[model samples]
Target: MTIRSSWSRAELGAFGEQVAVDHLQAAGFQIVCRNWRCRYGELDIVATDPASRTVVFVEVKTRSGDGFGGVAEAVTRDKLRRLRRLASLWLAGQDRGWAGVRIDVIGVRVGNSPAPELTHVVGVG
Candidate 1:
């Protein structure tokens, strides 16, 4: 098997998304979409839970550490607004008729120091 080179920021982000997917699944969130994008911005993960019929819009932020800022700190009000817009668009394209909707933020810090830590912040109105 050939191994691809990991040398770009975009590649790193993609890897982070994969890690985020595993983390989300382990937490019982069924994967709906990955890298869902619009002209405004992109959503890292969109999941649906069958038990609660809740649609969750998740923002995955991978950072080295709190050197510059924490992953959650990166989500600004404007960003949330954009994410909401995209989430609305996504829902409009679907007929799931979910019972509830939520906005979540999953921050991942991956490094050699320790195992990846996933912090899921739910209901980010």
Candidate 2:
């Protein structure tokens, strides 16, 4: 049996996240924020869904292989709570609150392909 390494997995995950962001842009999501970090947590991407007129808080997860778990599995209840708190801080800093607020997840699988597979789960929370 071969033992996989953590660093390799992290690198692949990061690459997938980059692809996911590019996919989001191509899909007409205007990126309002990226990698917004606070003492509590970080938001991978914050975008505006034009059709819905909503502020989208995006959580990006990337996976190389599903042996351990899918990318979405990384987002736990505690993680969501932290994300919500960070989102609040972000909105407060911007001094802007629109009619709609949506939580989205962008899951990406990184591989040899030029464009990775992107699955966007909208209003997940």
* Local accuracy of candidate 2 as per-residue lDDT tens digits, 1-125: 11223437667656766776777789887889788888887888898878767898989887655665665686788888888888888989986667788788888765535456678887777
Cα-based RMSD of the predictions, in order?
A: 3.1, 4.8
Q: Which regions in candidate 2 have their CA more than 4 angstroms from the true location?
A: 1-10, 112-115
Model 1, 8-116: lDDT tens digits are 6676567667777898788787999888888877888999877898999988887655775776687899999988899999989896699999998877766635466
Question: What are the clashing pairs of model 1?
Answer: none
Regions more than 4 Å wrong, model 1 = 1-7
Instruction: Give TM per candidate.
Output: 0.86, 0.81
Q: Which lDDT value does model 2 have at 89?
A: 88
Number of the predicted model whose lDDT against the real structure is largest? 1
TM-score of 1: 0.86
Please report the TM-score between candidate 2 and the true structure.
Answer: 0.81
